[model samples]
Structure formats: C-alpha cells, structure tokens
Target: MTATTAAPAWRPAAPVPCAAPLPAVDRLRVAPRADGWTVTARVAVDPRDPNLAGHFPGQPIYPGVFVVETLCQAMAQAVPGTPRLRAVTSIRFLAALLGGDEMELTLDVDPAAPAAGAASPTEPGWTVRGTGRRHDGTVTAQLRAVFDAGAGA
Candidate 1:
C-alpha cells in the first residue's frame, strides 16, 4: 500500500507595523468581464513622492517598483475579498514613467481562478496581468502577479 500526505494549509503571517501608507491610484475604475475583470486607473506620479528623491538628481524618473506597486493595488481592488500578493511572475519596464505623466493602468484578472479568500494550497490562487500606458498609447510597463487568499479573522 502507498501512503499519501495532503499539502499543508497556508496562513497569513503576523502583521507588521508600517511606517507609512502605500501610494494611491487615482480615477480608478473596475469592470467585470465574461472571463475576468478589468481595472483601469490613472497614475500621476507625485513630485513629492520620497521614492523620487534619489532616483536621479537632475533627471528623475519614476521607479519601477512603484509602478509594480500600482498594478498590485489595482488588482487587489478589482478582485473581491482581501488578496495577498504571493509572487510576480514577470514584469517589464518599456519606457520611463516620469512624474506628472498621467498613465492609464489596465489590469485583467482571470475569473476562472479561485477567489481570494477561498484559495487553498491545492487550488492555489488567481493570476493577474496588466499594462500601463500613456495617453499617447506608449507602453510604460507590463506585469503579471499571482495572489492568494489572505488570512483574516
């Protein structure tokens, strides 16, 4: 006879204090699709954003980390329940996301995947893909992220 073991359940870690709140997305909009959901948001980099301070003295450009953060935030909002980011499969920065550049972010979340709060080790979670583009249709960035249900009381 062969023995089998079930995968261990996943749980959220202890909460850690944060120094400050993460940046916000403006003019955010979420719409449901037949296969998934789409989120559209306007991101206008703030000149006062501390991240831009040392990015470059003379020619400061928007940091790629912030751009990815924006996409993660948008996905969390579009999807139901509290979703914790697990991994970023891929991300690409095509052009500089400069300050004051009102870029439009569009994210697509697969509806066929398990819901955030209902995900399990066997079921895994959901996948989200998106792109940030300027008004002129210039692609600023592209990314794919995986999320799982968050632990909550």
Candidate 2:
C-alpha cells in the first residue's frame, strides 16, 4: 500500500524534518536548484531525528527508504514543489546511511527537464537524479526522483 501525506494550509515556524529515513517526509534545506545551480550541499545524519527507533535499535542505520528520502529532500528546491513531495522513481539505496555520518548530497538535474515543461510550470516537475556520497566518494545511495509541483494538488 502507498501512503500519502497531506498538510493543512498553514506553514510552520521551523521546517519539519523528514520523519522516517525514507517513506517520505518534509525535509530539504533549500527550495529549488536554479538553472546553473552546481553547488553541492552537506547533510548530516541525525540520531535524534526520531527515525532511529524502529529502523533498528542497536544498529540504527538510515534505512534505504530514508536514503532515497534524503535525496528527495536535497533536490526538492529545484522541483517547484516547495513544502511538498512529488514522487520518487527507481529509488534505491546502494549502501547504508548511518547516524552521525556526515553525508554529501549531490544532485544532477537533467537540463533536458525544464523549469516549466510543455505540460506544467509553477509545478515545474524535475527529472532529478541524486546520489549520497561519503567523503571518499563512496556512493551510499542512488535515487531517481520525478517531481511535479502539482503532485500535491
């Protein structure tokens, strides 16, 4: 079964963190990636993030779902779906994202994918692909996310 999360019309003070490591949540720092936004951002794994409880007690590694979610969060700004989550396709976690491990999120937005497609604009969906890498370039996770702003609508 697929789960859908809906938020009321009011915005909150602090941004809500992604609840589970995966399975969807409200996270991501920036809004969207600009045309030439080539900068890479660092994301830290938090043990206090509440996702650890059920993930595994003694070994609370960030689940593959959340690893996909992390990529989702990192690329959200570029998707035109502020405070919203679209969809993730071909999402997979190659390795485990562990708590306390500093994570580097790198996303390469397909230039072929537009800010506004022939179909939608404000909901400029993005054909986004992201990978979570450790300092050594070890790929922990790889994600293929297709985001449409209207997805929430």
Candidate 3:
C-alpha cells in the first residue's frame, strides 16, 4: 500500500504584546439587505500602535492580519448571537495599509450559504465576504471568511 501524508494544520504567528490597545473600529453601521446584510465600518490607525514599531522601523505598514481581524469583528457585531471565525477561505492584499491611515471596511454576509462545522440551518452562522478600502476608494484587501454559529457562546 502507498503511504499517505496530510498537510500540517495552519496556525497564526505567536501574539506580540502591544504597549497599547490596537486600533479599533471608529464607526460601524449595519443595514439589512434583501440578499443578506451589509456592514460598514471605519478604523483609524494609530501611529503609536505597538505593532507599528517593530513592523518596520522607518516605514510602518499596518499588518494585513489586522485588516482581516477588523472584518471579522464587523461580522460578529452585525450578526446576531455569538459568531466565531471558523476559517479564512481566501484573502488578497493589494495595497499596503499604513499606520495613521483611515480605512473603510465593508462586509456582506450570506446566511444561506453552507455553514462550517456541524452547525444546523437554525443556527447562527454565515459566510462573509468583504473589502477594505482607503479613503480615496483604493482597494486594500479582499477577504472571504466562514463563521460558525454559537461557537463563541
């Protein structure tokens, strides 16, 4: 019989403690749509964010992971019940998110899509797709994520 190998599980880098709390969504608005729901959020990057310090000494660029976290936060807030991020299906970063930059994040959630894990239709789960854009409308990133229902509860 031929041997089989399984790919290693994916894991994020170890957390780096920050001197201060990381940036947060300044404003968030949620509106229901016929298709699903729409979430608009704004985040103001702080120059003093500890992540900016060692990220680059001279040139501090916002970490891409932070952008993803921002979108996940928006999804959790917009959706009812406790939602937990199951996986990031895809994400593309087109432009560098710089420190002190103001970013506009938009998320669209589709509850009809298949849920991850063993959650049922009656559960509170969704598939989320979103984009992060600069004030001038430059697309910084596009992401798709799956959230499990009541996982955080």
Candidate 4:
C-alpha cells in the first residue's frame, strides 16, 4: 500500500486491519483500541529475543527498550492503519522487569491529547503509548511516543 502524506500534526499511518491473525511465535496477546493498544507478554531472555545480551550479565532483566518495542507491536496490532512509533519522547524504567515477569503493556494513545500531538479523529495520524506491568502486578516501565512520515516509519 502507498504511504500517505504526513500532516503537520502526527497523523497515524493508514490503519491496517488486524484480520491476518497473530503469529504463533509471538507470545504476546494483543488487544486493540481506538485510543491505543495493549499487550500482555512474557520474556525468557532466550537467545531468540532480540538484544538479550544488552540486558545484563548473568542476571537478565528484559531490556526496557524491548518493552517499548513490544508495546509498539501491540499498538500496531490494535490500531487501525499504519500507526508506527515516530519517536519515544520519554521512557522511564521505574522497575526492573525480570525475565519471568508476565508483562502487561497498556498504551494510552489519544488520551494525552494536546501533549501527545496526535491527529484529529478524522486524520490518519495515531498516537501510541507503552506500559509494562509485570506478572507480579508491578509496573516495570512506561513509554510515551509520537509518529509521523516515512515509508516504513
């Protein structure tokens, strides 16, 4: 599909329907919403997970960056169109998420409103957020993001 022109505000990419179904390899469960996407996932720190080494030596906590990426994937699955993370404005690692923690990523896209710089309801621009809630019911981290422009951006 052709990419749409980006507006002054963050316009979400054209919404891509999530009818294709989730991939079996994905341990993440995606719940889509008009506002933003939510994801529940687990990390084993296996070699399969990207950038496992960057986490730490011996003690492997899931990388906070990965948490945001996972949330991005979840939001993409949920959001209609080509909503992509333009940038992570702010990310805070409030807690260390262990490999065993079942992470809950709740992204609040439209809620931030003016600050989020999201597009109008009628606009193609979409907002994205990242929240990491561990299986232990503790918050691991939170991410706020904005996206616009580019072919695969």
> Largest lDDT belongs to which candidate?
3
lDDT tens digits by residue: candidate 2, 1-153: 111533223221234344533423232333223462331446566666677766778666766666555555554443443434455666666677777776666666643354534334344555666767766678877766665543345
RMSD of 3: 13.3
Candidate 4 accuracy as TM-score: 0.58
Better of 1 and 3 by TM-score: 3
Q: For candidate 4, give the lDDT of residue 107.
A: 60
Clashes per model (N, Cα, C within 3 A): 0, 7, 0, 11
TM-score of each: 0.73, 0.60, 0.75, 0.58
Candidate 2 to native Cα RMSD, angstroms: 10.0
Native-to-model Cα distance after best TM-score fit, residue 13 in candidate 3, in Å: 26
* Model 4 lowest lDDT segment of ten: 1-10
TM-score of 1: 0.73
User: Where does candidate 3 stray beyond 4 Å?
Assistant: 1-21, 115-124, 151-153
Q: For model 1, how does the per-residue alpha-carbon lDDT over 23-142 read when each residue is reduced to its tens digit?
A: 546656666655666667676777667767677665567788877767666655556665667777789999987767777877777743544433343455567788889878999989
Best by TM-score: 3
Compose the digit string of candidate 4's lDDT tens values, residues 1-153: 112533222222223334421221145444444554344443333433434455565566666667665655555654455466656777899887665555656565553455434543333454555666766768878777765421343
Error of 1 at 72 (Å): 1.8
Query: What ranges in model 2 sit over 4 Å off?
Result: 1-14, 17-39, 78-85, 111-124, 150-153
